[model samples]
Target: MSRLLSKLSGGQPVASAPVSVDAHSLDPQRSAEMLAGFEAADIGWFWESDAAGRLTYLTDSAIAAIGAERDALIGSELTQFLATGDSDDLDSTSRPLKFRLASRSPISRLNVTVQTSQSKEIWWEISATPRRDANGEFAGFHGTARDITKSLAQSRDSERAAQFDSLTGLANRLRMARKLDQTLTAFKKSKRSCAIMLLDLDRFKKVNDTLGHPAGDELLKQVATRIKKLLGDHGEIGRLGGDEFQILLPDMDDRGDLGDLSKRLVQMLSQPYSVEGSRAIIGCSIGIAVAPYDGIESSELVKAADLALYAAKDAGRGTYRFYSSELSQNADWRQRIEDDLRDALTQQQFLIQYQPIVDAKTHKIASLEALLRWEHPERGRVSPADFIPVAEELGIINKIGEWVLEEVCTQLSKCPPEVRAAVNVSPIQFASEDFYDTVDAILNKTGVDPARVELEITESVFVGDLERTLKLFKKLKKRGVRLSLDDFGTGYSSLSYLRDAPFDKIKIDQSFVRGCSADDNNNSALVSAIVSMARALKMETVAEGIETKDELAMVKGHGATHLQGYLFSGPISIDELLDRFDSKELEFKPRGPEKYRAERRTEFRKIGVIHGDSRYNVFLRNLSKTGARIEGLLDVPVGTDLVLDLGDGQLAVATVRRSEGFSQGVEFETKLISDGDRGLCTRHRVSPYQIEAAGRPLGALTNSAVAAYTTGSQSVPRAFVEVDMNAYNRR
Candidate 1:
């Protein structure tokens, strides 16, 4: 082989001959031809631009791919033919392609989109080096470009898959978290507000269990669609997971607007859904938290919204709640209640109270409605509203409900056979597969006639499996038990169900009864319509919550067959009821407040009253929309203006209207609004912006934190002098 190489080397000096190649292959023209062939094959293309960013040259194949002639593309501005890529990595420090070109900087593997008249877009990965003349004067950019459209699309699909939920096609938890973080960071700099609402579909688990998971999945999709339709471009909605959703609304801080939106969302979500020929009804609970108010960080804001959501659910599903600092404490209390509820039954913490159902025409006691009450040993008479839901959540509601049923049956046996007793049933207990058998066993054990026991069921029982609900009603009716629909108009109010369900009586919801006396209220018309319908169906109508004479007269005029409420009697113990029956007090004379007034919650909370640099510790005895009654300030004269610092940033400027002894009735300058849980709160609260301006963190402000905006102001003229109640007492 060495002798042959020496012969091929021309036989002159083969000792140090360099590696040999074909002479034709070494020609510069042939090399250039090979490079041109590579370009024509679409492996890559060459591009050049002048110092003015005008395209000087482009490969013929590249121009052909864009459906343009080389001559036409040559003089076009580069930016006119290509745009900067929308890459996530483009940060604050990144420069645009035009700026890079102007600065004569080298760019490597920069992804760009080619502008074209074609319907389809083309993506190019480009690498370029800025060229200069001998004098180092900026000349142009010389670059190689490659088509990366297919790879870019694959990348984008992967990114979308990672960010969006597969089931509902909404943003998943990871994406939502990142979006919240980014939004909060950006909004912090602009000092703009953002609201985050976290919602969970109520009874969704029941839907999943009753129907298959596929139906639940379909329901979730419909929920997402409805939310998008209602929100449109107002916000971004995401399904965090399995019936839980999060909404991001930017630049919205108004509590009134938030409250309305929350209510609308709940209502919209509560509408019945048709899933695969099966009807599914579910409600939603919303918890809303605003940026720089509830929290400034993403995690903190999400937690606040979650706590608010829990409060909404605890208040009874199908409602919304705005986050207050107290919600966290309430959440802890709820957890404690849930723990305590597990043992409530065995500990005998529950008792039954009966409220009389009177005949509207005769004003005579017709029957009694049994209500469940829980008296926590430590908490002292815990409201059923506060603990029944906890029992339900802890899966002990059925047990408690069974106890109530048995106890009510025993009490009904004690009452005269003519006086019947109505027992309230929870949807959970009513929907049990063995509910019919349970009722039969209880009746057999107590030896009470079924006709003397009316089973009162709320509208919620009609939510899932209507056929089954109708069958349950049939079974109960077959046992000769009277069936009554309780809180009739407060829920779905489906006329279709009312048409088929065998309801012996229809009870008007207290909400309607509460406002029936108002001349302008639509509740009167609703009650009239309900009564007319019930009469047509041969069913009796019972007006609930008739607390005033006017309300009683209105329902009676509207043709209500029976009346039940405080006007007749409060809930009494079974012993007290027996005693009343023994005393022959079956005829109830209506005795209640003369007029229907705003609901005033009775509470005992110590709060601060600021009057001209003096902060007095006073006990708030009762609070209402227009005024509050406070004690501990003796001899506070009328017309004295004071700032009431209800904790959690609620500041009310009130003037004492009535002063007697140590108690004062003060009217609010601005009426309070519903706090979403049967409580009253100021219409407006201390703004986080003010807190920030006061050099404190943006959140629910402490009294000291908000004092700068409220009592800290010294410019206001004093209306009255501060009186030391303690000093007067000492004297």
Candidate 2:
């Protein structure tokens, strides 16, 4: 190479016009040998430069093959094309040829992608050696380059095909599995958390069935685009076959964030899609699982997520659910609970607290309603919703009911003479033939006035033998004990039962009180109707479960004669009641929420707050429709936007309205709504974090090799490996 360049430069290094072959500079045999070597080896082209690194020589055939005129590239530096190479690709590992030339090092099989005259990339394998002048000073270089574009392109295409989905341009199942497994393993050692979301398009089958699979595929691609845009650069999404997708959010265990992201996903995907010039609508359900919390491994985490997904679907679709160990329990657990409930009263797990029912007219305590509480030895305080049905189904409610009556009578005998006690009777226990005698004996034994006791009955008693039920009611009323219906609208609500039965009071169910202030709600009207009917029957009316100021105002304006719920007071322990009774404060004051915007729910659950790429563990102390108070973060800035991960997949985007040490009050970007079961949910949410945990490709997928199907091109994409549905089904 040095001998050839020396001849081309004529010993003294000087910039000169590039010439193919100068017969005058070389011997005939040598020139013929060089030409033959070029033809025989099929080396693409060669160039020589002076010490100034200016192109002094160029091969005629190479210049023509590159779609370039000889004059244009002749005087240009060889590094001109290096600038236009794949320099913008962050993953590129190729050492640039320009740097090697600057170092005056020998270039050995260096690959450089350069643009041809026609604006096409032509990859070349370049090799060069520095030539020396007669004095052995550095002159220039002579090297050979061969086009390797085809081979390189083939290799990249194969790799992309193996890893990416051809349809949606998202990560395929194999890639997602590998990525998730790798991520969990790393996160586990650091004790960091990761959250994964499993979602499938709702009504996707109907789309396929009605519009055909092609349209479904198009809709899916659009869905992918929308999700990618929503997540932007925050997450990685993978298509795990059919309409199912898996999302890997690294370093995120905040269910609140995941839930918000899920809601956003459902809402976005559920929006009407214009496919094939026709409008189509669809929705989605999401299940979320976190690493180290749900599972340590990818498969276990995925299974947990799948269970949550089924739960979300079971919750009537278009929602998200977080995986919990409770979701894994079976029927055997219920049986065990039933057995435990039978022993609850005997084992001393039973306790009673009282909530006062106040007279609406004078705001004085009319009666204290006894509410049963059960604390399992192993399970702490068991919710009535969890154990009451078990007792009823096992026929243990009769003993439990009789014990509550006896216990309440004994306690009420010591209260002020005017103070009354109310005990709720289960329909099953109420129907027992000896139940009346037990109540009679308890009242006699305790020496408590029967007139001071109120027995709350449900409409369920009227289900069997109405004549006997009406007769039993009359017998009970004759005993001088007051009777009032409890949970009025929840059971077999029959006005005829009221007409014949001598009920002292009619209690309206709490369900009618909630949201009664809404413009479209009919609860106010229903409350008024019940109040009017009770008035005509000469029975007083009690509004039950009044929890909020709005509800209190609504029920009061509607003419309820009495009220009972948390607004006046929750169930107070016997000690607290004794203190109140001793103080002669039977007249309870409404000390509930004075502010209309007080915390809707005060919570202590740990959640996540994300600012930038950093997620801070915070306690969700209070949450409301438009704002939340988060603790555990120190000195957060006011006016900063943060995402709160409220567990499962619930995520709320909030801006810190007030900030102090370890606490921040934030206003939500979008207000939350009731999930129909007292839980709050974002209007649209899903977990999204700032970290590129799936290495960006999982969240940001726009690989061109698989772009044919994913890009917004009108043409059909090229071939890809097909999934055999028959074989897949067998598996």
Candidate 3:
């Protein structure tokens, strides 16, 4: 009896226990009364259910704790009052409370939620034993339940800490990885596509250097908030540590839509951020890779996306790139260039050429725009588009800018007083503290007239501190140098900046000028508005990239003050300019295409054309976004359906729209998009997995190769006669 009392009291000693108790004191009825009293006093409560799992009995205290009357809970279903908790050890073999009661099995410490009348859910740990009749038939269950809300809350907190970023309440690296694995596994079965985007803040390092770490943290939080607001229910986003973030978009493979979304992300992230009462500005670069096209698994997809991101950063830090098979090769080439660029400055491999910007009305030179050229010993002349970005990435653009400034000043000293020279400046160079001093020293050393030197700065310069930028402009103005806003309407052009900052000229971006003459194009109206606005602001306007006679005439009619493009002259050497100046021949005749045409890239390569069951060899003449021209087929009917095998698994469905003597103009059903290297590519390509399933290696296949493998047993059913290329060439 004493032992029983001690066990009921949870191993606590019973005070003044009789050594020899009367028979009634140790009776079963007495024991039941003591157990009931102990349960009412302790944190646990008792419950019972009938064989049908309906509540048969419950302690009055337990009923009151749940804010329910005895009558209300007596016949209620037991499972309706409780739900299973997220216990780590629960698995397939661990039966639920209802299943255990039905199977007449003992349940030990199973966690579940108890629903209450007050609409509150409380977690409880429960243990139950089955009750049976004298015939050994299952009857009901008797259980003890203790509230575990506090401990469960702590456990949940720990789990959240492990899975989420502490700084931004977004999923951390571990959670993102697991979720990506699960999503990919499921998507593979459904044959649906997924896309992953990897992005990193472009100028975040500058923010951390200028402000403190705490401020940087606040900036990241704001970035996450902005992303959430933009994405909403579209996708899942996670921070992959530091300034890097990852996004998982399910069932999205359209590059056009992806490109638009990426552009929006870049624009949103580039906006000004207010952190702790200080304004900060930054940008982000995105790299995208779609599943089954770029990769098949999480790791592969992540690596591909990272490579794309690297390419975007390499392309000048304010763009996005989609993954391609050739990106790995390009990445390697980019690394080599970055390594070689550091020594190119000392090797005397860089030179300057001047392109003449002429007056639109007089057709004479207004100012010579200085351009930088890099001559690689092995690779010949490297495009400025390629090397300038490398220089920016290497943090040597400022040094290169200073060199150009000094050289321009020296060149200006030799030119006529009316022939001013404009030098381009990068945002990195313009932000330097010593930029004004460097300009002053150059003018002083070269003894060039300040009026003959103009500084050309892009709109990106406005992304930094506006006050300091204005101060720098004032300092340069005090030195009598000219300031011209370059690529004026390309980016976020604000009228407020133009009104506040002193400038002498505004150069319309080439994009606006290229198609200004088209009847359907809005660029003509845009250019007219810009020119009129510039006139009102008392600023000179220069229309750039005037490659056609129509474009030149249109801009001139729009009241542009200056024009610069190939129609006047390509970039000329200093000696060539001096010769032209010495001969007193500044006026140049306009020479270029009369009207603008869609730029088609010329190509000479063999491809395959599949019509019906026959595949024929054809020569691809030229390619464009909308259509392609093919040769080696005679008298193919117009409106004939054919598939052009553009190698590398790019199969484009085209229709022969124009047929003439072995040359046909085929218009693609789906328009091709930019391949990020000034080349056009199909929006979707055949997956390598599909090729592997066809008993071929898992990689890109040539057009002829795929044709031979696909139509092995079938005989060719030629609908049109194939022209003999050798005979045709001889004729």
Best by lDDT: 1
Q: Give a tens-digit lDDT track for model 3, residues 1-731.
A: 23333333332222222122342445555655666565658667766677888887766777777788888789999888876755452444656766766677776777788877576667877777676656977767666777788897888789889989999999899989998998988987776788999988987876776677999999999999999999998888999899999999998987778888888898899877777776677888899988867777788889899998987887767678888766888878878788888888899899999999998988899899999998999888888777887888788998899888898888777788899999999888888888888888888899999989999988777664667888899989989999999988754577878999999999998889987999988999999999999999999999999999999989999999999999989999999999888999999778989998776889987888888778888889999988999999999989999999887567899999999989999999998887544577787766655666778764333444467654533565578878777666678
What shift in Å separates residue 296 of candidate 3 from its native position after superposition?
1.5
Q: Of the candidates numbered 2 and 3, which has the greater lDDT value?
A: 3
Q: How close is candidate 2 to the true structure, as a TM-score?
A: 0.49
Candidates in order, TM-scores: namely 0.91, 0.49, 0.87
Cα lDDT listed for each candidate: 0.82, 0.73, 0.81
Q: Name the regions of candidate 2 deviating beyond 4 angstroms.
A: 1-326, 329-340, 375-380, 431-433, 464-468, 514-522, 547-553, 575-583, 682-731
lDDT of 1 by residue, 535-654 (tens): 999999899988999888889999999999999899999898889889988889999877788779997777888887666677788999899998877778899998899876788999
Q: How accurate is candidate 3 locally (lDDT)?
A: 0.81
Q: How accurate locally is residue 526 in candidate 1, as Cα lDDT from 0 to 100?
A: 94
Off by over 4 Å in 1: 1-31, 87-94, 133-136, 634-640, 660-662, 697-700, 707-731
Write model 2 residue lDDT over 1-731, tens digit each, in one string: 44454454343322222226665677656665755565455555666777777776666666666778767777778777433256433236656666777788776766676656577777766667787877989988876666778987887788778889999999999999999988877876665778889988866775676568899899889989998998887768989899999888887755456766777787777666778865566678888877765676788889888877865764546678777554556234666786677777878999999988899877788888998999788878877655776676587888888889989988888788888888988766887789879889988898889998899997656642466777888888899889988877652465666788999988898878776766776989999998988889998888988777787888899899899988888888888988888887777677675323333787767666665545555677788888988776666778988878765345678999998776789999878765423457654323122222422222211212112211233354522222232343368
